[model samples]
Target: MRTREEQQSDPYPTTVEIHCLNQFLMEDWDEEWDRISEELEEQDIPVPEGYYEIQKQILDLHQDMSVVEILESEEDDDGEMWYTIIDVEEQKIHPGMPRYALMFADKPYSTDIFLDNVFRHDMRVPDSLFPQTWKNRQAAKYQNM
Candidate 1:
């Protein structure tokens, strides 16, 4: 491993900073959906048809098979710290896996920080946290991009 000096010279953005960007992304996401819904409804068009085209045309998804949402919130102002990406077609393989996530807070000591947080709501004592052997394949989506 590199010494402390090496780590400092090649600094990576911390988790919390990435979380802040996701907060803004979620807000823009909701507002965009709301605007599209309103336009579709005003024109008396089917939601699915309008939404699909608008997502690709206006939102720039280029297809009609992906979904994005904050992990736990009903509105943009809810200030949730995590978000997920869903590929509807790939759901058959994992059933209902949360594809990926990004979060904010102090950087963690272990790579499994998010998985650990999922099992125990408590965060004060790290040792008290139970071991989760379940397979986890995840990483930061851009801690600050």
Candidate 2:
């Protein structure tokens, strides 16, 4: 586990290694975005470019979600760290689990740490549970950058 100070000082500051199982749900955005976009297009509704590329997707557990497990975290050929997460039940249901997805550390995801631990917190990741001091520090750090 990386300390909060270390995470804050990191140049990239987009990688995180979670303990094991963490609950998360997609926040502020629908997981069925593509399908929704298609429906909107069919209805002649114009979709904004902001929703085009998927980046910094929020992850907070939905009420319907059972369990989310962090299988592993590894960097890709491009040196981008990607964490493999899977739905436990989904994997059991389908061998080729469609719910399995790669999550970037830069993205938003909910964790129980804020309610329990703070020394290992990462301010770069947005979460309402994070202390205000850490949030302010993160903001200032980015402003200077």
On TM-score, the candidate that comes out on top is 2
Lowest lDDT block of 10, candidate 2: 93-102
Q: Each candidate's lDDT (Cα)?
A: 0.37, 0.43
TM-score of each: 0.22, 0.27
Candidate 2 local distance difference test against the native:
0.43
Query: CA lDDT of 81 in candidate 2?
Result: 53
Question: What's the number of clashes in each of the models?
Answer: 3, 4
Candidate 2 positional error at 120, Å: 18
Clashing pairs in 1: 16-104, 16-105, 18-143
lDDT of each residue in 4-105, candidate 2, tens digit only:
344465533433432222233343234465577789989998766754433223322222344434444555577655454545555532111122232323
How big is the positional error of residue 35 in model 2, measured in Å on the Cα after superposition? 4.2
- Runs with alpha carbons beyond 4 Å of true place in candidate 1: 1-27, 49-145
